[model samples]
Target: MEIILVPAFADNYLYVLRDPASGKVAAVDPGDAAPLMAELERRGWGLDLILLTHHHNDHTGGVAALVERYAPLVVGAGHDSHRLPPLGRAVADGDRVAFGGTSAEVIATPGHTLGHIAYWFAQDEALFCADTLFALGCGRLFEGTPGQMWESLLRLRALPDATRVCCAHEYTLSNARFAVTVDPDNAALRARAEEIAARRARHEPTVPTLLGVEKATNPFLRADDPGVAAAVGLVGSSPDRVFAELRARKDRF
Candidate 1:
């Protein structure tokens, strides 16, 4: 499987996945179809599937246009179908969806939204996690509790270290700034922040971050770590409480 990054409305990212063996194509969160269409035309590919992570407008805004153009099979969380564009296949946590040569496991990740979910292609080690997890940050809690978001992050953190975290935003620079404020003494984080700065300076995408790097440097994924907990003044507290504090501080940052 090959992944292509397409920039959408102000900082949002839309991913296009291709299965080499079958020449099958799938798009994740097409916020704007014009760019995606242009890319597809450039590559001479036809869309076959559309995987939606949530019901947010920025993510689903292009779905209607793409569907009208390619008539692709649209998949989304069953619980969120009422709000999302019509889903050809409504799935829930743990459900398997077959692509060209491999399949993906739908992992329920409800933090950014109550019905948000991520698609994990084990064979490709790719995780299309829109808004749930970012490069050096996590999504804002719009419709879920701290505990819920914490548990959701835990599940993502448990994936293989080499997993490519295909998150849907270009917020790494700002996230790195906030991360250093909490994990000030982390050498790995400082180094990663510098790299992110450099990448953004050159106007390059700094996402599709490795899960291992995120575990080591992303403060949101390290709320349970003693250093992160201590930095937030919640050393002895549960990870959820620490997460809540970290999230609150980030919101205000």
Candidate 2:
């Protein structure tokens, strides 16, 4: 599979995945059709599938346009089907949807939004976790509780270390800034922060971050760790409580 990254709407990222064998193409969280169309035209590829993570406009705004053009099969969470654009197929957690000659496992992640779902294409090692998980920070509790988000993160954290976390935004630098405040003494985090700063200075994307790197440096993913618990002033508290405090502080950060 070949994956292409297209930037849109200031910080949002749109992904185009293609299967080398069959030349089938799929778009994930297109957000905007202009850039995605341009890229497809550039490559002379046709869209065959559209995978939506949530109902957020920034993620699904281009669905109508893209569908009108390509008539791609639209897939999204059945749990939030009403809010999303008309879905050709409404999937649930653990459901597998085929695309580009392969399939993606739908992961129900309901913190950023009650019906948010990520697509993990195991064969391609890509996890399209739109807003539920970021490089150093997780999504805000827009429509769900901290516990829900924490559980969502835990499920994501259990994936293989080499899995590429293809989250949909360019919020890594800002997230890194807040992460250091909570995991101050973490050498790996500090080093990664410095690296992120350098990458941003060069206007490079820091996304598609490795799950292994995130486990080592991302504080939100480390809410249960002793150092992270103490940093949030929630030592001895349950992981969910510690996670809640960390999230609250981050919201203010």
Candidate 3:
């Protein structure tokens, strides 16, 4: 399986997942259909599936067009039927959908939206986490409370450390800036920020970061770090409060 990241509108990403054996592709959260259509045409592969993580316009707006052009199967939230603009299958958490002769497990992670889900390809160790997890920061609390978001992140953290996280947006640089503010003494983050900046300077994509590396360098994953707790001034009793304080500081930082 090859994961192709198509940088779409603004910071959004539409990922094209390919299975070499079948010569078929599946895309996650296609904001618009033209670019993905062109790529599929270039690769001489037919789109076999459309996996929607949520009902946000940016994530599902292109569903109708793609369905018209390629007639791919659409999978999405069961609670999001009306707004999905012609969904083929209303899926819920734990639903497994097959694509290009393989399968992706649907992980119900509701924080960015009430019915948000992330697709995990355990075989490939890849996750198309639309807006639930970012490079350094998590998605905003548009539909759920901070605590709910916290719980969702914890679930994600439980995945294997080798998992290659394929988040939906390119907010790494800006997120790194705030991460530094949360833990000014973090040498690891500073080095990583520089590396990420250099990668951006060369017009490269800083994706597929391992979960273990994020645990070491990303403040959003290290709310219990001494430096992070000190920087945020959280003298709490539980991990949740420390996480809560870090999130609040990030919101205003």
**Ranking of candidates on lDDT, top first:** 1, 2, 3
Model 3's alpha-carbon lDDT is: 0.83
Q: Give the RMSD in angstroms, all C-alphas superposed, for model 1.
A: 0.6
| Backbone collisions counted per model | 0, 0, 0
Q: Write the residue-wise lDDT of candidate 1 on 148-213 in tens digits.
A: 999999999999999999999999999999999999999999999999999999999998999999
Per-residue lDDT of 8-103 in model 2, one digit per residue for the tens? 999999999999988899999888999999999999999999999999999999999999999999999997899999999999999999875788
lDDT of 3 at 148: 78
Q: Order candidates by TM-score, high to low.
A: 1, 2, 3
Model 1 misplaced stretches (Cα beyond 4 Å):
none
lDDT of 3 by residue, 102-146 (tens): 788888887788888898888888988889888878887788876
Best by lDDT: 1
Clashes in model 2: which pairs? none
Q: Against the hidden reference, what TM-scores do the models get?
A: 0.99, 0.99, 0.94
lDDT per model vs. reference: 0.95, 0.93, 0.83
Candidate 3's TM-score reads 0.94
